[model samples]
Target: MSIDFGLIFARMPEILAAFWVTVWIWIVSNVLAVFLGFGVATLRRYGPLWLDLLLRLLVEIIRGTPFLVQLFLLYFGGPFIGLSLDPIPAGLLGMTVYSTAYYSEIFRAGYNAIPVGHIEAAECVGLTRGQIIRRILVPEMTMLVLPQCVNMAILMMKETAILSIITVPELTLVVGAIGSQQYAFVEAMLLLALFYWFLVELSGFLGRIAEARLSKFRFAHS
Candidate 1:
């Protein structure tokens, strides 16, 4: 049977709307996860031993499990524990928590990449710890960590498709609905792939811009 690409393009408005839903979820979830991961790593790196152990255990547990299971537990299992959430919020919460574990490791690696001599030099220059972190460490750590963080962000964007399983009204779910309704599974699926590809390309473009801007700081300093 010949395919009618025209029918799929007819639904472009709905598809684009669904795409925005996916984008918003990804943006909010990644923002929260990245910052929270940094906070977790910083606390674990500098906090008391007991706190470090506790945070380490939490990260380990999250990293050890599949995100699908966590999403199910958070959305389907929450009602049993007297916590209820709508599908979108539950999905966002699950994604943020799960991604935070991996983001924390990326951040930890960035921190470790810093040279001891740099910190010592800042100390020798009479910079306070806060000033050293604000003026010295954060800038360098961002440069070191950005590529890995971008990779994770792209991964998270793809993973947002899974939120469709919980009926989050994201791009995949909308596409699935249209496919079933129109009996055009092949066309719908192709559109789905194309949509995701666009998102991935956009992410790569933005990441390149960020990396380029970060590079300028180094040249300016030099």
Candidate 2:
């Protein structure tokens, strides 16, 4: 069968609009995930035992389940619990919860990697716990975990496609609708792949640049 590249060209506007929607969700979710994950990691390290156990259980539950199931529960099952949410909100909530679980572990590993002596030294300097975390631990941990965070960020971006199943109007959903209406599944699938490829590549490129600059900053400071 012959391919019609013109269909892709004609759908460029819709594709671009959906692409931005995906990116926007990704940005908002991951930003919240990063900070919330760090907080979860920190609490697990230093908070009360009950709180730690509760968070640990939560993290494991989130990590253990499939994201699609989680999204479905949030979007479809929420109404049963008197907590209904619209598609975009449900999608964002699901993405944030899912990403936060993994990001918490990534940050937990970063916390472990820091030398105990560094914390001891900060203590000797009369730095408060919050001060040390903000001024020292956060900066060091960010540098150490930048690569892992980038990988997670890309993973989250791809997972945004799953939100299309909940009818979020993201790139994948729009493309799928086009494919269904036009009977051009092959062309639609190819175009969808191309858009995702560009997004992933762009994320990786930006991640590498950030890593390089951070590496230089660490080296110079050392």
Candidate 3:
């Protein structure tokens, strides 16, 4: 039997919605992750020991757990607590928290890449702590942060696949549903894989653009 391209086209809208869901998660989670990660990274670098330890402990806990387990716990277990969530929100929240912890280390490394001498010189010039961080450390670390931040954004896009486990109707979940309903397993999966590959490529392309922009200024990390 010949393949029905027209049938696939007819179902395109559903597929497109799934694709949008995935993109939406990526956008929301990346925004959240950047803020959460930056805050966590700052706490590690500038906050007191007690706050640092608490933040580090949270990071460690997240890093040690598998994403799938975390999703299950949040989706299935959260209702028992006061924090109930719908599929989409729950899935995005899981991805946000997961990305936040991992991205925190990357951002922290960017800050750490700045030289101690630069910070000391800022202090000697009578700049306050906020001034030193804003003018010297952060500016110097921009190049370092750019690559890892983009990479983390791309990684989060891929991680959105796990949301399918919770029936969020994102890309993977839609593909699986359509495949089963249509009995076109191979065809559906191939299309889904192609979609994901395109998404990743697009993200990588944007990252390269950002890297080029950041590379204009040479920050000596050594």
Candidate 4:
């Protein structure tokens, strides 16, 4: 069959709007994940044993489930549970919940990866626990965690597709609607694929710059 570049290009405006929504959802989710993950990691690393256990359980539950199911609960079941969130907000909330679980795991792993001697050195130098983690662990772990966190952020951006099931009108939703209307399934899908590829590659590019800047700590891993 012949290609229809015009058809695909014409539909891009709708897709562009969807792209913004997708970006916003992922950005807001990652912003929340940063704070939530730091707190979760700190609690798991140095807080009471009970709080650590609770965060571990919570993280596992969030990660073990599908994003679609989580979106449904927030978007559809929210009002039933006394949370009548706007559709966009509900989708954003779901993205935060889903991303936070993985972010927590990334940070927890980074925290654990710190060498025992590193902490001991800090302590020997008279640093408090908080000071040690802040001054030593965080500086080292940033090199370790940034790459994993960037990968997770890319995944979260792609997961915006699930928001469509909840009527959030992200990239996938717009593509689907156009594909149905134009009967240009292949073209529409190709555009969607291109968009996702761009998003992933963009994230990787940014991550590489961060990795290079943080590569000083690769010595730690070595």
TM-score of decoy 1: 0.93
- Clashes (backbone N, CA, C under 3 Å), per candidate, total 0, 0, 0, 0
- Residue-wise C-alpha lDDT for candidate 1, range 117-218, written one tens digit per residue: 888989999999789878888888888889899999999999999999988999999988988788888888887898799889999899989988887665
Give the least accurate 10-residue stretch of model 3, judged by summed lDDT: 1-10
Q: Clashing pairs in model 1? A: none
**What does candidate 2's lDDT look like per residue over 1-222, in tens digits?**
988867666888987899889999999999999999999999999999999999999999999999999998899899999988999999999999999999999999999988888889999999999999998888888899999999999999999999999999999999888887777878999988987999899999999999998896462332
Give the TM-score ranking, best first.
2, 3, 1, 4
Q: How many Å off is the CA of 105 in candidate 2? A: 0.8
Worst 10 contiguous positions by lDDT, candidate 1:
213-222
Task: Encode model 3's per-residue lDDT on 134-156: one tens digit a residue.
Answer: 89877777777888888888888
Q: List the candidate 3 regions with Cα displacement exceeding 4 Å.
A: 1-6
How far is 60's C-alpha from truth in model 2 (Å)?
A: 0.5
The true-versus-predicted C-alpha distance at residue 210 of model 1, in Å, is 2.2
On residues 1-222, what C-alpha lDDT tens digit does candidate 4 reach at each position?
766757767877787888888888879889998779887888887889999899899899998888888887787888998999987988888888778788888998998888888788788889998788778988888877888888888887778888888888898888888887887778888878887898789889988898888787674442
